[model samples]
Target: MIDAHIHLEQYDSEVSEQMLRELPSLGIEALIAVSMNLDSCIRTQKLATTYPRVVRSAYGFHPEQPLPQETELSNLLEWIEGQPREDFIAVGEIGLPYYSRAEALERGEAFDMEPYIQLLDQLLELAARLDKPVVLHAVYEDALIACDLLVKHNIQRAHFHWFKGPEEAIARMIKNGYYISFTPDILYETEIQELARRYPPELVMAETDGPWPFEGSFAGKITHPSMIRDVAAAWGALHDYNPGQAEEILTANTKRFYSL
Candidate 1:
């Protein structure tokens, strides 16, 4: 099965190399390596070039970090614009800073969400112009804003990875025919499992979001693309489907979404 979203660039070089070698045996096919920033995009592109059959890159800024300066933003946009169309699969790992702003507010720090919203709007505009699918990081209230921007730009091919939000947002996404990916947490997190139950089988896929760890049965282990097999297992269990069948459905959904 393919990992619908991962930060392969974040993994240690030796570790990633070893994992790539093991993928065939693991029944793992390809990874959608989403970028965190310009540097991350560069690294991801290199990995994709090195293993073109295994690593597919997605270029965009992650929202958890501070907003970029004007020069930085311009540079990133230009860089993404210059990349060959086939070089990256989507505009990804981009959205409002929901977790960051929530943490800051709880600590009595002031946080402005508008700039992040504008940033996402610009990135969504780029994705629309390029006619590429989007991999989003938006969750909770931020997801509502993301849905609005997606509609504003008529960006229909959206994949909300490791998503969590209210029923309203979920209904909107389902209605819009957007896709969603399940992480390994579906094995243990009730919230994630509930989402698995809600999303349509054809509109859903599996991911590791790797180089970032997971808890439950995944606790303390290095995240790996092969773990998505377990994610499919858990998701299938939720809907009373067996593991092999689950993996096949998710794999097809991923291929259909990314045009892999």
Candidate 2:
């Protein structure tokens, strides 16, 4: 099975090295290591080089964090493209700011949507140019606008990771043939279970988003890629499929989406 979206570079070096060595034994065949910033993108690239097939990099700025300087964003785009295209699988963990927008408002900080949209547009253009899939962080009300951008760019290969949105957005995603990935939250989150039930297995995959931590049974435990096993199990339960079958379908979906 594959962990569809995770920040492997965020883990401690010693810890991540050991985890990467242990992943295959735990039934995890690959991970899409999504980046948060330029530094993260670089580290993810090196990790991908080191781990080869086990760790694939996805380069992009995360919207939940502070907006990156225009020059920095430009440099990242250049750096990613300058590298061998095979070094990365997609452009992502990128999208509009939703949770951060609220936090900025509460702090009286200016939150500009223009820069966010501009950044997303550039990333989408890069993905379209490279013919690579995208792993999105877009959710809830923000999902509608993200969908519009995907349509605008004519980028059909998009994965809305850990997605939670209104029925209309979900319908749009289904109609667009976009993919969705569920994190370990599916084990205890009723809303996520409903999403797994609503989205067909053919267009769904599993992820840990590891080192981001999680609640429920995952609380207090070191979030690891191995946890995707439990995620797949929960996903199977929602769809009335067994764990083994879920792994087969999800693995195929992940490979097809990222061309793994």
Candidate 3:
């Protein structure tokens, strides 16, 4: 099975090494290691290199964090351009701001979106130029803007990871044939279950977003790639499929989406 999205670099060295050691035992075939910034991109690349088949790197600045300096962004782009094409799977963990913006506003902190939109444009342009799939972090109104930008750029292979939006936006994503992933939250979150039921299986994938944690049955557990199997089970139950069959379908969707 494939963990379609995760931050393998976020874990401590001991945990990371342990997880790597257990990959085969857990039945996890591969992981799409999504980056949060230039440092994360570098670390993810190193992990992929060390673990080869166990990790596929995806480089991008995560949208929730403070935007990077122009020089930093330029360096990151240069680094991406210099890498072997087969080493990275996509340009991802990138999108317009949402949750973080809300939190900042609630705290009366200054929140600006102009820079974020600009960054998203540059990332999308890179993805289009590279002809690679994109993993998005856009949600709610941000999702609407992201959809518009994707359409404008004519990017056909996009993955809206852990997506959440109104029905209309969800419909648009389905119509556009974009992929969306469900997390372990689906095991207990009614909304996630409904989302799995609504989105077509071919366009659906599973992820643990490991080391980020989760609630319900996943509460108090250090998130792991192995948790994705439970997500697949939830997807199966929601979609009226055999759990193993759902896992196979999700694995196929992830492989094709990332061209693994």
- By lDDT, the best candidate is 1
Each candidate: how many clashes? Answer: 0, 0, 0
Model 2 residue pairs with clashes? none
Give the winner by TM-score: 1 or 2. 1
lDDT by residue for model 2 (1-260), tens: 88999999999999999999998788788888999988999899889989899999998889988788879888988987887887888988899889989888999988888888888988888889888888898989899999999999999999999899999999999999999998998988898888889997899988888898899998998889989888888999888889998888888999998887
Residue 250 local lDDT, model 1: 96
Error of model 3, residue 95, in angstroms: 0.6
After superposition, candidate 2 runs with Cα above 4 Å error: 107-110
Measured by TM-score, how close is model 1 to the native structure? 0.99
Candidates 2 and 3 compared: the better one by TM-score is: 3
lDDT of 3 by residue, 1-260 (tens): 99999999999989999998998998999999999998999999989999998899999989988898989999988888788888898998999889899999999999989999989999999889888889999998898889998998899899999988899889999999999999999888888788888999999999988888898877899999999899998899877888899899999999888887
TM-scores vs. true structure, each candidate:
0.99, 0.97, 0.98
- List the candidates ranked by TM-score, beginning with the highest: 1, 3, 2
* Deviation from truth (RMSD, Å), model 3: 1.0
Error of 3 at 184 (Å): 0.5
Tens-place lDDT per residue, model 1, 77-182, is 9999999998889998899898899899999999999899999999999999999999999899788999999999999899999899999999999999999998
- Candidates sorted on lDDT, descending: 1, 3, 2
Q: Residue 179: error of model 2 in Å?
A: 0.5
What are the Cα lDDT values of the candidates?
A: 0.93, 0.89, 0.91
